[model samples]
Target: MRSTFYTEDHEAYRASVAEFLRREVEPHHGEWEAAHGIPAEVWTSAAAAGLMGLAVPEEYGGGGEPDYRYRFVVAEEIARTNTTSFGVGLGLQDDIVIPYLLDLATDEQKQRWLPAMAAGELIGAIAMTEPGTGSDLQGIRTTAVRDGDDWVLSGAKTFISSGMHAGLVIVVARTDAEAGSRGFTLFVVEQSDAGFTRGRQLEKVGLDAQDTAELFFDGVRLTADRILGQEGMAMRYLMERLPRERLSIAAAAVAASEAAVRWTLEYVHSRTAFGQPIGDFQNTRFVLAELETECDIARAYVEKAALALNLGELTAVEASKAKWWTSELQVRATSRCLQLFGGFGYMLEYPIARAFRDARVQTIYGGTTEIMKEIIGREQAARYARR
Candidate 1:
């Protein structure tokens, strides 16, 4: 479906992003997959192309625009090429890390960090998922105790994206033993800090080019200035910003489904079965028709959600609906598309194989599908109670 969500400026930006990916990223993706990480030079090049930070203030050497459509366009163009690894870096920078800095940082903190982040000289990661806690924010075991002039932190986190390459990590830890969610706080932990160590780069079923790892913080000391926002308000902060994160994931999921449908259509048309093109079969045509309609519906919903998110009006319940529904569609669409490819679908050389593997995590991360349904159900119950 042709979308009216983007304007001419967004279209121009999309063209530039497409060119950059085709020229700079496509050639190196194979090597990056083999290496299990993208090189620092790619980040530098992305910074040079003004692709690193779209919403950051120009004073910090960024685009200074808060329009999310531009970010969505970049994500769509990347998805069109079957590039998932690059999306992780862009999504982390634009969706996850930038908000924490923009919403919580003090003037001095912004000055110290924003420029490097904009320039891609500094990579950022949010350390929240621990060995024991995945989605339970209140169950975090990491602790930060106040000293005279510093805070001592001790904990371990696993499944941290960009952990191995991140120059700055936003560490979430408990500040009060009995306060539950109110006791949590965020701290900026630099890579150079003593006692801060990164564990092995994790190998996963997919997204081979993106770095995911374990992080260790043992007696890591941070000065008072390193704290982000008001202390002991991490849960509040996270709740306020999670809508955009969920919206971003939903946007990417819809884009992936669209790409999968397009790829399958092309494959079916070219490959013959029983001396006839597979596309001539009624089953293939019906499957493509259904997938196409679903993808169009998903894109429309995600586009509306993106606009709501940009206006600061998207709610947790709405985001949860989008996240769960679109991710489930992506998983289903990728699997069906791969099935259309027959034996070739099982080979790693096929993009369908990679997309199938990658789609499995969409429902699991950014809040599980079951978790989303619970949130939506609770909100409905509250509304009924008010009536």
Candidate 2:
């Protein structure tokens, strides 16, 4: 069944995204993967193609569109090309970082940052996870001490996506020792800040073109203007924005799974065994049938969730459900699809090999499957208790 989730405008945007990828990303993505970083030019090219900053207002030099389906179209197109490294990098910008600034930055701050970010001249990242911290924001050890006219920050962040290229980073730090949850604050740290330095880019098994690195702040100083939102409101801000972030992941998962099935379907129809095409085999037919059904179901759920997010009705519980379920589905879909390709799937030349590797991290990042389950479980228990 055809999904009515996207409008003609969204489909039109999807066509432009596909053309942009074919012209700019497809030819050079493998080179980027080998280099462990995408060139700065690609960012500018994407911005020129109007692929960046769909949610930023027009005053900031963006498309001024906030519809989540536009972003979903971009994800779907990128997944089709199997250039997920590029998708992951851009996801950090649009899904994670830009939303923070749009929601939290003061008007002056927006004027200062949004224009450049929308232009792809200033890449942004959020520094929340530490070497020891993953999923627990309260456990962040980065500290920011108040001075007469400055805040002295000292901390290290690990696994920061776009760390190598981000011109600005939102650093989460503990500002008070006794306030517990209210103790944390967010600081906008610039790359040019004195005493701020980037550690080596960390390597990973997937999304190799996207740079993840360790960041170090040794008494980096910031003025009051650098604060994002109110002091001690960082936790609240993070919680509020998570629905969009997780839903972004969920949408991408659905797209990637669908693409994997498409690729596997193409491969099975052409590759033959036992004097017939593999797709003609009963086992292959059954596997593709199962994958397609699941992909369809996941797509429906994600489309509904996207609508909920647009309407501000998506709860953290629902977002967590979408995030965990579709991510796990992506892993399953890619793995099973890869199996259908036989030995070719294991080769780097095949897109399935890359998809398999890239799918592994979907269930890990944006909060783990375990954490998502816990959130849902706790919500369920709370409802039962209320009853």
Candidate 3:
């Protein structure tokens, strides 16, 4: 599973991240899960440890090093600890939100938000998915009408990750009602905005520590400066960012699969059945072999995707292939690992159980497995047609 992609610096970074997760996150993750949100202190502590701002520029209290490998270290360590909630929340920030600001935000906008975001003071969330429009960007019903220098925003966003803690949110809204996909715009809604409200914290079957909530924009007025990039550019912005987002999911998926294999390996070796260790049995050995081989392959694929993303050469189709493959691999790995644990795996107290629970949503979010395949398939068909 060793790769030439990581240097000593990456390994050193991994050690630091592992230490932080062990000291700050491991003991308290259960508490956060029960509350359905990681605490503000955790965010601050993560920033202090240089975990939150890998993508942020150095001028803005960040590492300023824009390598995806550092982010991969964070994802892998979180997966090792089985902190999927923390993993997803951090992904929303580092993988998804920061890139928007990096690529699209103006200097003044960056000056206003990046420092706080780097320091974890201004928690950011993107309000995209509605109750009705899962990944259908064209179907978002949220509206923003230009009224003088302000845009009147009226809509509700459900399943918003980091919804409860977000001090700054990028709200996707329809700016031109008749423009279809071109109608959508991205607006930055601050926490203190009038009529902007966060609704009930959603209870999910997994990633319980990540706060997923309903957000309401009841005629919240936003200035022209609050607009990101340009009016009616949300869909394009989304398309541009899709590769990194999906790759982030892929990175986490591979890591989770590896973790599942690691956990099951130890369990099967130590726990005995019949006359010897369960791992000694042919069935367990075969399962372990398949799981390990699959994880190793996933690791290679994700690393390559990460490199491609760094080089700005990662295509949507490539990202989709990685995303769908690793997501399904994670589900399969967790399910198989949990099976090895027998009844103990079904109990919530076991980490394997949490892995099994958390793995279900991997193929569902970041665009479903079916959607990823469709994207890849469509591109392949178009290329073949041209040929």
Candidate 4:
């Protein structure tokens, strides 16, 4: 189906993104992957190309475009280039980290952080997953005890994306143990803080260029001004912002799946076996047909959700469905596509090989598939009970 999700403006933006990838990202992505890190210049280059902060307001040095289609274009272009590590790093900044500051930070806080973030001069990470906690935000062990005019923070966070180079980290810490969910509060922890430390860069199975690390806060003292939004409302904030994050992941999943199918289709049509193109085989045709159909369906749903998100009508339940379904589809799409490539698929030099590896993490992060299903199930049960 021809979708009306994007306009001429979006296509124009897409061209720019494609050009940006060709000029700035593609040339250096392999080296970054090998080094397990992206350099600061890439971020600034993205910012210079007006790709860094589309949602950020123009007054603060951003493009001031809140429309989600622009972001989708960026994701699609990045997926086409197969520079997913750079894409993930950028997504963390735009989707997860900047949104928090944009929505929750005070004017003072925004002034201090937003401009640099918009310029891509400063990187940010949100540290929510603890050593003991995965999906349960309530289970975080990080604590922040209030002193006269300061708060003493102590805890550890793991699996933090952009952890190694983030100059500013939004750390979720427990401030009032008795308040349960409300007890958790968000604090901005800067790299210059006395006791803030970053552990060794975590080696991951995929997203090699995107840095992940363990962060430690030992007796780190924060002034009252460091609190993000209202104290003891971190849970509410996290819940509110998660749909965007999940949807971001979902959009990437669709783009990756689509790109995988495109690459595989091209390869099968050209690569010959038994005096015929591999695509001539009924089995190959069937597989590609199914993969394309699934990608289409996922894209339609994601488009609807993206439109809903722009209208601020996207719900957690809706985003969860998109996130889990499309992510799993991406994994399946890449795996099947890789299989079609035969022995060549396993070779790291092939884009499909890297796509296969990168797609595996889609189901694990943002939120697990199990957790997404549970959220949908619980919501359904509640609706049934009310009826």
Give one clash count per candidate, in the order shown: 0, 0, 0, 0
The candidate maximizing lDDT is 4
Report lDDT (CA) for all predictions.
Answer: 0.91, 0.94, 0.91, 0.95
Q: Which residue window of length 10 is worst by lDDT in model 2?
A: 1-10
1-387: candidate 3 lDDT, tens digit per residue: 356989999999999999999999999999988877888988888989989978798998888988999999998999999888888988998999988998999999999999999998889999999989997778888899989988999989998889988999999999998887788898999999999999998888889989889999999988999999989889999988989999999999999999889999999999998889999999999999998988888888889989999999999999999999999999999999999999999998999999999999989888999999899899989999998
Candidate 4's residue-wise lDDT over 1-387, tens digit each? 587899999999999999999998999999999999999988988998988888889988999999999999999998999999999988998999999999999999999999999999999999999889999888999999999999999999999999999999999999999999899999999999999999989999999999999999999999999999999899999999999999999999999999999999999999999999999999999999999999999999999999999999999999999999999999999999999999999998999999999999899898999999999999999999999
Lowest lDDT 10-residue stretch of candidate 1: 1-10
Instruction: Report the candidate with higher lDDT, 1 versus 4.
Output: 4
Q: RMSD for all candidates, in order, please.
A: 1.0, 0.8, 1.1, 0.6
Residue by residue across 133-187, what tens digits does model 1's lDDT show? 9988789999999999899999999999999999999999999988877899999
The true-versus-predicted C-alpha distance at residue 8 of model 1, in Å, is: 0.8
Model 2, span 1-387: residue lDDT tens: 777888898888888999999999999999999999999989988988989998999999988999888999999999999999999988999999999999999999999999999999999999999999999888999999999988999999999999988999999999998999999999999999998999999989899999999999999989999999999988999989988999999999999999999999999999889999999999999999998999998888889999988898999999999999999999999999999998899998999999999999999989999999999999999999998
Off by over 4 Å in 3: none
Clashing pairs in 1: none
